[model samples]
Target: MEFSIKDIIEAGEGYHIEFKEFLDKSFVEEVCAFANSGGGRVILGVADNGTIKGTHTDNSFRSRVQDSLRQLQLYLDIEIRVQDNLIIVEVPEGSDKPYACSRGFFIRNGANSQKLTRNEIIDFFQKEGRIRFEELRNEKAVFDNDFDERAFENFLNMAGVSRSIDRMSLLRNLDCINDEGKLTNAGVLFFAKDIDFLMNHAIVVCVLYKGTEKVHILDKKDFKENIVENIDNAILFVKRHTNVQYKIEGVQREEIPDIPDVALREAIINAVCHRDYFDRSSNVLIEVFDDRVQISNPGGLPSGLRPSEFGRKSVTRNPLIASLLHRINYIEKVGTGISRIIQAVDENKKSSVEFEYNSGFSVIFRKLDRTSEADLGESSEKTKGKNAEIILEAIRDNPTVTREELCQITGLSIQGVEWNLRKLKAEGKIKRIGPAKGGHWEVIDYSC
Candidate 1:
């Protein structure tokens, strides 16, 4: 929705970008494909291969285009952007999907659009869960009543969308509101001032315990704010309770936590991104114990993801929600959160993370052994060798990596990293390339 025409032309037509040399009746069919799938742009006068051959269309053509969509009964406005001969039609996704024209239901498949038959329609609904909860229109959501200008501004700033676009048009383009100005479920989660009455179960509850059990409570908080606030607050709650080791490098100080912040944040986001919004029974839970921190959301693993395929595959139960989060840079476009969490914890020298999705998906991060960490004055040869190995692997992965970053990745204090780097340099295994500020490390030998 925030894309530039020049960029669109350079990128060429794809699933989200459809090239049309002239205005034709088949344009409605392209809209059907966009509505059924993710919303995309239909650029008129552009060649299929992205050659910009302009075409002209006035207000009457736009009116006709809007009036022609009556057959679909979708209350979505077809946005038409004019630039001399080039006309761009911004098609918002339909709330009621499986959108079809005269021929059949069309779905976007990469650079092409496919028209599905009757049998395919049924299969499509079954495979895609009929309708996503986030895309549904909330009958009770009145834009005047539920709109949170602050949250909307936050989203716009974070998403890099300009404020010049008409508020309603921007909302419609973002699939947050229908043509009727009604907010969609995704809209409510992100922009609603208060979802307590709208979506009560969407809350994120974070609790800290004295021990590994549920007997004593150290701190408890129920974040009933919007999705963004809920995630930030939940992570803040855990960080407040978690321990961090301080390491001083000259005047600069680095604090390495008991768990990697990246891993913890990813785990929390995965919990929210994959959790079933349809299930209003349980809120996402982030529990910090003395020994470990457990984060769980009430949707096992979406329908398609298998036990073995979870960390390797990318399948989202809430596509719209995932897209929104992705726009804000909260997570990756790929399904690498699980593998990332595992790698982060392993690199930190923390105990292995336990992933469970029996009743609901849960990520458990085990706390480090503080006693053994303090006793690093004299470690066994095997322990020293293992630390050396972790450091080498980390350095290989990132040559420009600093000592502070090494502290985080190796789960070592400043002192430990200094000791290892000294040993590695003495062993002639690794050497600094240049000035510490603008330099890199060069691995001199193959051996540790």
Candidate 2:
């Protein structure tokens, strides 16, 4: 590619561009960094302040520069072009990533080349999918030592698999065990008797705060069970804390959670399935505030996925874990979780869900407006007089109906149904027969 030196100066140094007054030994590090990250062009003969000092160019000088890049372990084809007095080196993004130099492993951070620490290098490999966390065998994990037979049996039942296949055979078929007979990390997470003991960061932490900020905690629960159990329990915690309303359709009443249950469930499942298992410091966090509920996991989106293809693309960081979950019907499809979450929220007419991707991935479900809840409550009360007539008619139709049954028949909460019943009895419209347990509702005067 051709470049005008004036245009390069105006562009300055950034994530995909760098400026160097002259080529030095450090130019090799710059080349490696660009290849490791998004590919960028390093312009020699350009000063740090965008001053084009220009470098001495000859056939021998170009050969010497090429020789320096060859010192890298992996051979990279760098596009070297001499424009006027400036030398431009265009390095394409490495297909085989985590490129290194004799100095150390380096990556482009903003405009600079930063050498990675030992742990950072390992994390980079995992993020690039070069190393899968689920496939790695846990040295301390033994099938007989910590495997929960009951949990495994429950999973088989849910998955509709027969117990005719022995446990070891089933495990092997599922890729939960390696040839050495040691359980893989995926197996330990899914069937371990105590995941908290086996892997501390595999649990789910739920917190309910009094307000938006994390100042005062009203309730908190750390679920340290198998992956499925943790997901279920985390959802249960949210349901207990969030609001619920009764929706009456004819004679049947449905309890609708304030935040759509399907959306919340999908978020939780996505978090557990795609979270970074390599990061042992942080667990999946579910935080509920007065305004919103945020669910976050350690890892962001998979490496190759672009922002535009976020919900549309299907990339599994832990294929083994995802496959196991899919077998048990926890996940319906590979890449539909995000879309399903959005659809659930929209169908419920709840506030839109927000997705954030940084060092970690987060889904925030906004709560319904307080004013809207008040309006709904007001509307329900206004229709209560008519609802009372419906209740009376229902009691006449079924004299053996219980209060709980009235709740179902009338499309009201237990408390709402009870209040209506009490008002009817006070008006001499209905009565109860026998004990509360076996009692039936009776119409007294049969007047609305």
Q: What is each predicted model's overall lDDT from 0 to 1?
A: 0.76, 0.77
Clash-forming residue pairs, model 1 = none
In candidate 2, residue 181 scores what lDDT?
68
Tens digits of lDDT, candidate 1, 87-171: 7878887767667777677765444565665465445557556667887898778889889999989987887765666677667
Among the numbered candidates, top lDDT falls to 2
Question: What TM-score goes with each of the models?
Answer: 0.64, 0.56
Candidate 2, residues 55-148: lDDT per residue as tens digits? 9789988998888888765888889999898788889888777677888777664456766654555565565655467767887776788899
Every model: Cα RMSD to truth: 13.5, 18.0
> Candidate 2, overall lDDT?
0.77
Flag regions of model 2 displaced more than 4 Å. Answer: 1-126, 370-448
Model 2 RMSD, rounded to 1 decimal: 18.0
lDDT, model 2, position 49: 71
TM-score of decoy 1 = 0.64
